[model samples]
Target: MADVIKSLNLLETLKESIENNKLSDVKDAVEDLLISRINLAVVGDRGDEKATFINCLLGLGPGDDGSAPSPSPAAPEEVACYLNPKHPDFRLWDLPPVPSTSPFQPEGYMEKVKFPRYNAVFVTFTQTPHPHSVEVFLEARSLQQQTVYFILFTSAKDTEKNLEEKRKASLVALTSHGVSLPKVYLVRPSTLEKLDFPGLLEEMARDLPEIRAHALLLALPTLTPTLITQKKESFKALVWAAASLSGGVSAIPVPFVASMVDSSVGVRILTKAQSSLCLDNESVERLARQRGADPARLKELRTCVLSVEVTKGEVKKRLAAAEKEIATVSSKLVEMAMPRHARSVSRSFAAMLQALNGAIDEMAADAEKIMAAALGKGK
Candidate 1:
């Protein structure tokens, strides 16, 4: 209910801007929407484990260009920043191992890593939760870093009882340190769908700032159907803003020329959607490689035309076609939200909304198929 109202308020704000011909403001809003930044810090001792966890988070295979390096025992002593290939604004910073001192001190380590800057923190360990790891979480809590995770990376071959025991031990250790309520996530980075990985992601989505959470959802690889659905729904507000921006830009008075602004907007929207949904060539190939599946075979699973390519010419044609196909139904709803003074852009807005919505649905469906095929499920 509150979320729905908030969404409606945003839509109304955009509509008001379009009605008043505030195209520049609308453009800024859309730019901010598409480029929000999320800084995630993965704090753990094991270089190999950190690399694997970071790779899985960023949808990269071990050998991919932007994947974290599983450095030898002599890992780099400084913080290493791993850029998300799909979204430059999003970053994963792998901090050096917390010093294994008898009396763990987190202040110097936190300052060195600029801990306050990260939107969220993940403290990971292979077995027992390190004393340093718990101290780090406690320090982060004191510093108002509310979004933190204590993760135990367990072997897939480990029995359920063994996993439960490890979690209990970790919780006990955390509680002993005055943590009122302690929660630990047991995961296998190789298979994020197993154990507590999905729940951890859900908590991240709920706990982080709204825009950063949205960025995380869209930037992550389409691993689970639940995530796929969340990613698809996250685009709703973006689609509305994009279409409104298109309408607003076109509404601006230009001497003796018809504005074809929606084409460019549509192209940008779908291109971002393509990458966010993991329909782009690079993302598909990386996921395929990570799952030991042939990239070409996975690519064949993407049946949507826009999922394959989003171009200006293609966008223009689709916009016109979608407008014609859904105008009767969409126009009524769009018209209700648009003011009388902004009627000129109503058709354009409706067309862009229709085209982008259809493309997003098609791309999301294609991503599901690709993921299924990559996971050895028949397409």
Candidate 2:
């Protein structure tokens, strides 16, 4: 409920800024809400499992460029950061596991990693929950960091019964050590479509701050139907904000000249939406590689007009084509919310909004098709 209210409040604030013609505040909101920075730390040392998990989360293959390096036999001595190639604003930090000590001192370990800098901390383990890792979780709790997670990576051969037993055991250990409430996410890196990986993402979306959660949603690949739906909704908010900015600019009273909308604004909004929805060539290629398929086969599934390269000329063409139909709907909306004198501004805002929304809808449909095809489903 708080998340929904917060999102509405943010949109309301942006609407007010646009109404007041606070261009700077509107721009700042765009940066802060859509393209903000989010740091996520994955702590623990399962070597190949750890690296593979990171790759899956970032939509990378084991050998893809920018994927986390497979650790050697010796544990890594320092923390390493891997930026999401698609979304540079989202960073994943792989922290070295706590050193083997007779009596584990989590304070030294936390200090070494600069823990508080991360928006979410994920402590991973393979078979059983590690005491030292739980200690880190406890320490993070003390610091009032509520976005901590306990992830258990299971092997392919692990049966459902075995997984259930492990979950029970993990909860028992966490509770025994004074954890108020315990939760363990059982994941198989090879098959993210199965298991609790999706649930983990949902939890993160709920647990992280609003802006950070929005970043996470856009940064992730549209692997499941749930994620695709969430991404579409997020893009709607973005389109509304960008369109409002255009409307706000044109609505300002002028001396003698008329205000016109810029075609570049629509171009920028559509371009950002295309990449954020993972419909671009690079994102599609990455998703294909993760599925061990050829990129061209998946690219063929993107039949939407906006799925192609978004260019300014194409945007202008769309704006011109959509204006007549959009003006009718937009005029009615503007009539209800705005005055008679605001009709001119309504046309500009309505055209931009309709064009962007149309593109987003087409791109979202293409994304769904590509995801289904990539997952080996029939069209």
- In model 2, what are the clashing residue pairs, if there are any? none
Against the true structure, what is every candidate's RMSD? 3.8, 3.9
Compared with the true structure, what per-residue lDDT tens digits does model 1 show for residues 306-344?
899888888878888977776466556876856677667
Give the Å shift of residue 306 in candidate 2: 2.2
lDDT of 2 by residue, 1-379 (tens): 1234445555666667666666566666566545647898888874888888887778778777788877633346678888888678788888887666668788888888999999998888887777788888898889889899998989889999999999999899999887988999998876676799888877887788766787777777676866777777676666666665566554455321122257776776677777767888988887776666779988887887678788888888888887778646745665654334445567666777777778888888898888877787321
Candidate 1 ranges with C-alpha deviation above 4 Å: 1-29, 72-76, 102-104, 249-260, 335-344, 377-379
lDDT of each: 0.76, 0.75
Model 1 lDDT at residue 306: 89
Which candidate number has the best TM-score?
Answer: 2
